[model samples]
Target: MTAKYLVTGASGKLGQSVLRHLTETYQVAPGDIIAGSRKPETLSEWVAKGIQTRVVDFDDAASMEKAFAEAGRVLIISTDALDRPGHRLIQHKAAIAAAEKAGVQHLLYTSMPEPANSPLLFAPDHEGTEAAIKASTIPAWTILRNNWYFENVFLSASSALASGHWYSAAAGGGIAHILRDDIGRAVAAALVAPTEGKTVYTLTGTKAYSHADIAALIGAAAGKKISVVEVPLEGLVQGMVGAGLPEPLARVFASVDTMIGVGGLAKVTADYKTLTGLEPQGFEAWVDSQAAAFNALVK
Candidate 1:
């Protein structure tokens, strides 16, 4: 192999997981990999392992171009720029420009679920980025439209589980949630594989279920009674605001809940399974595996 792999945002949780998987599971040589981050110093461990870490900021074109100079493939890990409007899309566009300049052969981007169809508050940025990638001159690209993560459950589960109460905007819709690692693995698969003809995929869990089902799983695993409560979309946003999220972030969660309620997050597919040749984990299985982590975080 002529050493082809450039992972942007490698310091991020998902990026780190993908890097670990590539090294451990795939046995990819560290020297063949390149990681990009604003603070490459943070990746001292990976660097010690022989992976090259470079300071590449999406906002800084020169750094990005230098980072991808010799990279044959690029993974534009979506920026967590939700806190600022249009910031993520602009950053993505910049990365695409760099990838093009670097003569990168492929691009694997992380995208949200059905951004084109969902009005889930912060979907416009993803939609806009998708459009830009489509319009770009890049030879090949893969859009991994990942669904909601099972981790979101823990954020709302512990509090309500102890109180025997739960709340959500998704009234009856079922969510096909996957772990963050799964998303990372999917991204890696897209990045390294010869997926020239494949441009898009909806990655999700093996199964999908509504909140009531989620409560049931959590309750069964924890040996406690947990109730699932539905809230009006507007009330859901209000509840989020009361929880200390900024008005915009609160509304974003509310709309996500609304999307859940309307099956926005239920678009499960066999793409992940097909890509990785392994069945995706189920919602309950994820919760069970996180028992220790959840217990430590509880109380």
Candidate 2:
């Protein structure tokens, strides 16, 4: 009997993509995979395809244990419970405990690059989760340290297009932002083919792009010339807040520049190709593909 694979948070963007790649890209048997989501009903399509859909509430230990009990491999997608300090870590620890109690053979987790040394405010959550996973009794595990997503720039792209200015606090540092779907494809490959004990892969794009470089790419794609205006970190936060973002959320978003300015997310790696045997999407091409969307933002 082949081991069953369980993917937590299967209803999310990354999770859903992973499921698609597992069945489509890797041709994994749907019956051998379990899709775990807080609301499993959202995955009715998968359930109808002979896949097992189970509830995987991070806050509920008993349910999580039940979700993992039948799976030999488990992928724990990091939760987005950053609204409260320490809350995310608590949830991750519970998942680790549940996986151990359920006798899972291999555990995999989605983490950020260099979490322990990162300047991002949420780095601690990933760092703590990685530490907990390392301490768990699971026989084998894989840690994927994914870089920033290219889509993340869209958060400020609309406002930048509206004002014709891309403000930044990155201090000329660059970020190799990989596509979320590419990461999902790589993750699906990793989950299906278990690596040796305690392996880590840093999935990143081929090149790093500074704020100016990114602005140029977006400007060219949108047919609007956008200029980069370097500002202090505080100024960036204030601008975001002035743009109607909540102050707390603005600070959190602005921290990405803080992290970038320090070269925290500037590294490029080939690990993504190693996992999926294909190149991650390039920024220029990705921007070009989203050209219509960018044009709509300016209009």
Candidate 3:
């Protein structure tokens, strides 16, 4: 069994995007990369392209170990198993254990920024997963601390566009949001690049924007003026619940704003450009690109 590069959660958006960049942008051969997913059937297109597909079920440790066999490098795209508390951390640990058992040499993972001290609801999962990776026998690992995606703003942006007010719990705090695809490209580049020891990179846009700043950008792009309404954290959570989001999920989402208020996602770093030698898409550019979508929301 020859060693090859393995990417877990290959069916997901980030996973799929990373795979595309790996093959298209980085020119990694299909034969050299293995796309791992629980439902291998969904990866038919990848198979057609001559890429190897494997069943990497996090819940089934034996299956994961088998999937990791002959995998020299593995990139674990964090799963979205957030509905069940502690389940995601368990899944991540299982992947780490499987990689170690299979003698993986280099490992990589997608993580949230400042998870160790952030107030985000799912920070524990990332923090624990990072700890497990560090404790593993794998000699080298890369942790990509991805910031908030501009797409994530859509959750609240639609409502704000309609109401003419962007209600925010994060007072005067800013977030340096990068595009999801940008993060994926960076991850793909890092996976194939050489690394001597443990490395961590915080991937983010070139600048940070507060709620007011974001509202202004949206207004400029959509031809409508929008105001930023500062609300308490509890009020923000309640507002989301009123907007038909589940209470638990609403709180989890609102915690992002709370985290922002404390400067959690505010930092802008050059780590993204260092990885891919490319500038991440800026917020203004993202807004312009989504102009049609924003105008539709306004109407």
Candidate 4:
């Protein structure tokens, strides 16, 4: 029998990749999958093709409970509420409550690397959610404690290249940056395999690199000299303000830098290889891809 899988945030990049991976590799029957979110109608094609979807807003407990009505296993992608600080715990608590009430057999979560010491100021949000999952009445749970995604670098790099500035407080600290797609694929693997109880996996790449090294790669990719500039926490906050980032975001970013400076993001291990049984893509390879994209902009 095909197992039912509910993927929260189905419209997101990670969520979409999970769905595609399951369909293409796992051959999961479309009818056995449920994509829960605020706007289920947006995923009509997936539903039409047999994947079910339902409205499940984290803020609304009743709505979330209803969404899991027919789901046996659920992957609750963390909410995007970093700016508000305490909102994540609230949202996740609702999901956990609903999942427990609905008797969902297994639950999965996407978390950050070494969440206990993550440099991201948003780590509290992730930590709180993980704690709630740990304390939940759900029969089983899995936390994919993913490291910094190579894709996360790409996000800031695109804007940095456009603005001619690469900024960070991670001066000499290195992080094992795994591809976000790999995280998605890993989640799909975990969900497909039947396992019970709550466990946390620290997902990272086979290698690690510092921000300065990353800046150098970005420079090479764009065919221009890009330098890594590390600033003090206060200076970083000021820079963010100068760049028009909101006050709350600026402070959060600055605090995250302080965490990086203290080595929160530099931890690495063989966990990625152990979990996926495959070597991850390298930083240079990611740079080459970015170079290709930048070159295309000229064409």
Per-candidate TM-score against the hidden true structure: 0.94, 0.97, 0.97, 0.92
Instruction: Residues 1-299, candidate 1: write the lDDT tens digits.
Output: 24589898999999898998888867788999998899999999998999998888989999988888868888888898888877888998898888888887788888888898676877888898889888888888888898888888887786776677778778788889998888888777777786675478999998888888988877777767777787788887787788777988887777877788777888779999878888877777778887676555434
- By lDDT rank, best first, the candidates go 2, 3, 1, 4
Point out the higher-scoring one by lDDT: 3 or 4.
3
What's the lDDT for residue 181 in model 4? 81
- In model 1, state the lDDT of residue 294: 55
Off by over 4 Å in 1: 295-299
lDDT of 2 by residue, 110-191 (tens): 9998899777888999999999999889999999998988888898798888889989999999999999999999999999
Kindly list the per-residue Cα lDDT of model 4 for residues 148-251, writing each as its tens digit: 77877765576566665677776677777888887777888888877786778888776678877777777777776656777777787888888899989889
Candidate 2: which pairs clash?
Answer: none
Q: How many backbone clashes does candidate 2 have?
A: 0
lDDT of 3 by residue, 1-299 (tens): 45468999999999999999999999998999999999999999999998999899999999889978768889999999877778999999999998899888899999999998778999999999999999888988999999989998887778888889888999889999999999989999998998747999999999999989989988888888899999999999999889898898888888999899999999899999999999998889889999988888895
128, model 3: CA deviation in Å?
0.8
lDDT at 57, model 4: 92
